[model samples]
Target: MRPTRAGTIQDAVARCYRAAGGVEAVAEQLGLANSTVSYGTEINEARPGGIGVNHLARLAMTDPDCALPLAEFFAALAGGVYQPVGGVAEVISLFSGCGLMAKECGEAQAATILAATTQRPKDIAEAEREIEEAIAALTKSRAVLTSLQSGAA
Candidate 1:
């Protein structure tokens, strides 16, 4: 009942902020001003200049949950559902489980696209890694769900 960021991009930003351990940490990590980080994370609509697309990407890369809400919103807009991975690792993806799965999937997709467009070996290799990670995440998520369904979790 609580995939909190799934509802809005602003919520996702705030989630990312929390995932990063708050404004000061993210600000220090991203070399962004504290005020900018604060503004980006605030859920209030009155604030302007919420994180830019590039900054969002940079920030999202720092943590997994940061990207889940944004990904889910986009998936919904595209008439698809975003499936999250299980939260198993320290310093892992979205909401821990599902967010991680979606983030991995999205990163893999992006890598594949870059490989296709550039046809570079480095890009291809990165794509392969991304794909493998995504598959693992999805597999884990599936297993968890199966266990839950069978009342084994």
Candidate 2:
């Protein structure tokens, strides 16, 4: 899904709020004032106010499930891709698989190039396997990203 930068951070914060069972609950869990936890953010706004780094940290520490989504939303606001921390093993696995598949795809492409240059028979089978692996990796990556975006994983 193409996630809009608008309100993404606020939206993530809202998800955290819900996950923690609302602003007061979050405040209690994080040991912060209700106003502080709810400050500078509009859960329903298309674009809401930004949360400070300290507050974000507190939320993440209090609710690990919300960490990745929050960071990703903040990254979108910053005009960059969010890199997941090592907090979630599953996300790390997905990212690692993507990297390996990317490497394999590159190797297959290089083989195809070499065959073309040397007038050798192209390894169609190998090429197909590489394509499949790449597709699978992409699919997995997309799933992980969607999960992270939705704050469900």
TM-score of each: 0.45, 0.45
Q: What are the per-residue Cα lDDT tens digits for candidate 2 across 1-153?
A: 112345556667767677667778877877778876776354435435445667767877977776867777777778975643333444466658678668877876876666556664456555656666555556566766777789967
Residue 138 lDDT in candidate 2: 60
Worst 10 residues of 1 by lDDT: 86-95
Per-residue lDDT of candidate 1, residues 30-103 (tens digit): 89898887777455567533767788788778677777766776688799767664543432432476887889
Error of 2 at 103 (Å): 8.8
Q: What is the C-alpha local distance difference test score of each model?
A: 0.73, 0.65
Query: 144, model 2: CA deviation in Å?
Result: 18
What does the lDDT come to for candidate 1? 0.73
lDDT of 2: 0.65
Task: Tell me how far the alpha carbon of residue 29 in candidate 1 is from the true structure, in angstroms, after superposition.
Answer: 1.1
